[model samples]
Target: MPEVLDARALNRATLARQLLLDRADLPVLDAVTHLCGLQAQEPQEPFVGLWSRLRAFDPAALSDLLTGRRVVRTHLMRRTVHLVTSDDLLAWRTRHDAMLRQRVLGVYRTELDGVDLGELAAAGRAVMADGEPRSMPELARAVAGRWPEPGVRALGEMLVAALIPMVQLPPRGVWRVKAGVRNVPVSSWLGREPDPPAPDGDPVGETLVRRYLAAYGPAATADLRAWSGLAGLPAAVAAIRDELVSFRDERGRELLDLPGAPRPDPDTPAPVRFLPAFDNAILGYHDRGRIIDDEHRGLSVAGERVVLVDGRVSATWTVRDGVVATTPLRKFTRAEEAAVAGEERKLTAFLSGGDDQPTA
Candidate 1:
């Protein structure tokens, strides 16, 4: 019989892995890599995401990393724009190519009828090859002569999102900067082609499984697929199952995790954490009962910025008139309220760059 781990147990382990338990002292780049990447569709969200997980995180450092090319914002993992390290982008992009294409097509298939994806990809790549950052509309219009039926949105969705590996250049994701997405090919931006898929074995897939568990584990396979947006990891999971240990959640779903990964005691103290909208800690799992209640699950996908009190979703937060305002989902204990208030003050300072005023 597999050992049974309850929700609180999973919550503690998850918090430990997510660097929310004790803020990580790692460099931003290393932290980004370790967590695989931060979901960055909302350009400014990753800054708050980092602020919550890192010790004394400097938003300027993140901006510098983006400008310095140490990190890139690109479409990956569930087909969302993610702020990932350059190496992770090159190493993982190829593995995600098919999934990316399928994801784009899932929405645009009818419009894309009669279009040759190979030709479209070539066209998109050629337009991007001129070393200019092109917006999605600009890229799509450039190729519209070749495939007008798909419309700019559908064509651009496929081209920039899937067919060509593209990245959102700096200023779009640079801290405190509000900018539109302008894209260049991943190869052109990074000065290297993506690592080709392994012909003989599934090394990358195995690595993804290992990395996923190290970061988000004691998780079910469904949770893995939900996080990765890749459907083809069963073989990868099987290929490395023996190297993993298994446990069962209270719901009796089998959870797989790396042997030495931390599974903190259920009673471990959790600090109040204010997560940015669409945070990975909440959205990364198919079953989020460990960290959020089922009734409140919609909040995660609905883009509600949540406050975690005692390691559970306790309230929703927003910046109201430069104040860090919170609305409780359930009444908070006095201690929890104080913890939340104290953290919000620090967060306001962080978000405002010590201005004592909240931004966003």
Candidate 2:
């Protein structure tokens, strides 16, 4: 029989596993791979995400990782931009290619109708082969002869957003620095092409299951599907069930996790964690009620950054005029307010590059 873990048990376990209960000591590259990846469509979001989870995280470390080619930002899982390790990005990009293309078509089917995607990809690659950094608009205009009807915005959005394996180049991802996006081929950016699909078939799905369990486990296959946006991973989980331990949430949902992963005591005290917009620690699971209440669950999808007080989202926050401003979703006790203030102070310093200004 699966052990039934109540919401508190699950919450504490999730906090421990996600490195929110305590800041982690892992390197940025290793941390990126461990967390699967950080949602980074907004460019600067991953820095805040890292700052929240890592002890003494330097924004420059991630920036250097991007420039050093150790980590890369690309559209991968669910066709959203993520800051993923270079090795993981290369290995995983091909597997996601089909899904990425399908999602793009789903959105722009009418506009792309009668347009040959193969020819478009070929032309896009030929244009990128020159190694000059081109914005999406420039690339679209370069190939305007083939499908000029979509206009530059639509054409560029489709190509960079879906069709090609491209990386938004630096200065784009530099810490605290704002720059316009310019595109470069992933192969050119990383200096090695993404791994070819396995002749034995994609074991990446299986690997992803293991990794997810290690980092976000005691989770269900539904949770896995939610985290990955991949519909075909039950077979992957099934293939590795013998290597995993099974349990049940209080809801009687079956959960799978690595046997030795930290399932902290339900009473383990959790610290305040200021999560970045769309951080996967909350967005990673299908049943987020374990970490966030349903009443405020809309905040997760709406991209409102959250404040994890005692492992639950007790407040929402925003930064303006160099102040980390917060409003409680629930009333806070004096202790909770102190904790939130301390974390906000840290966040303000991070946002301001160690300026001594206090959080508003």
Candidate 3:
């Protein structure tokens, strides 16, 4: 029988792998790659996500990466905009192409009825071939003549999200700067096309499994599917089965993990962590009991920023009028409150550009 990991053990291990146990000293780009990518639909949230996980994280460094094109905001895992290193984007985009298309179609199936998706994709690409970044509506209008039946919203969502691999260009995600999304084709923005799909094997899928376990390991196949929003990875898991080790969760479900990945001691102390909306650490598992209570799980998907206390979801936080307000889900010990206050002060300072106001 494999070792049985209870929820606390799983939580400690997850915190360790996620860099919450101790802030990592890695460069920004390397940290982003290690975690696969940060859920970045909110644009500035990745800065907070990294600040919590990294020591002395400079928001400007991440902004520079976006402007430099070393990192890109594109739709990848779960059909959401994520901040990913350019190399990962090039390597992983093709594998996710079918899933991206399917997700877009799922939302616009009725609006897009009678539309030839292939021809539409070609037309969309032609419009983007000029190498200029355009808003989704602009791109849609450029192609609407060919398919006037589907309105701009339906056509724009499909074309910008599924048909053309696009990067939400810089100035949009720059720290403290508010800008609307303007997209350019990934190929033009990154200076190279996405790597072609494998001819004989599932290399990209295998890579994703290994990467997922490295960051969120002891995870079930269902968790992998949930995090990635991709189906058909069973074969990928099978191909690499020999290279992985297994354990059983308290519920008797098998969990897969990389051989040398970190699984910290169950009793390890966990500091309070403020996570950005849609952070993958919380959304990465089908069974999130380890990191968040079942009753509070919906908060994760609802784009609520949560505070982790003693390694579990304990509070939700928000900024109102430059004040960081934290509403506790449960009673906090004096020590826990002190710790939360200390971290909250730092976070407020970061968010307000060095204004260390007390958290309400």
TM-score of each model, in listed order? 0.98, 0.95, 0.97
Q: Which stretches of candidate 3 lie over 4 Å from their true place?
A: 355-360
RMSD of each: 2.2, 2.4, 2.1
lDDT winner: 3
Tens digit of per-residue lDDT, candidate 3, span 246-320: 999999999999989999989888989999999998999999999999899999999999999998999999998
lDDT of each: 0.91, 0.86, 0.91
* Cα displacement (Å) at residue 327, model 2: 0.4
Give the worst 10-residue stretch by lDDT in candidate 2.
351-360
Which order, best to worst by lDDT? 3, 1, 2
lDDT of 3 at 127: 88
Q: Which stretches of candidate 1 lie over 4 Å from their true place?
A: 355-360
Q: Is candidate 2 or candidate 3 better by TM-score?
A: 3
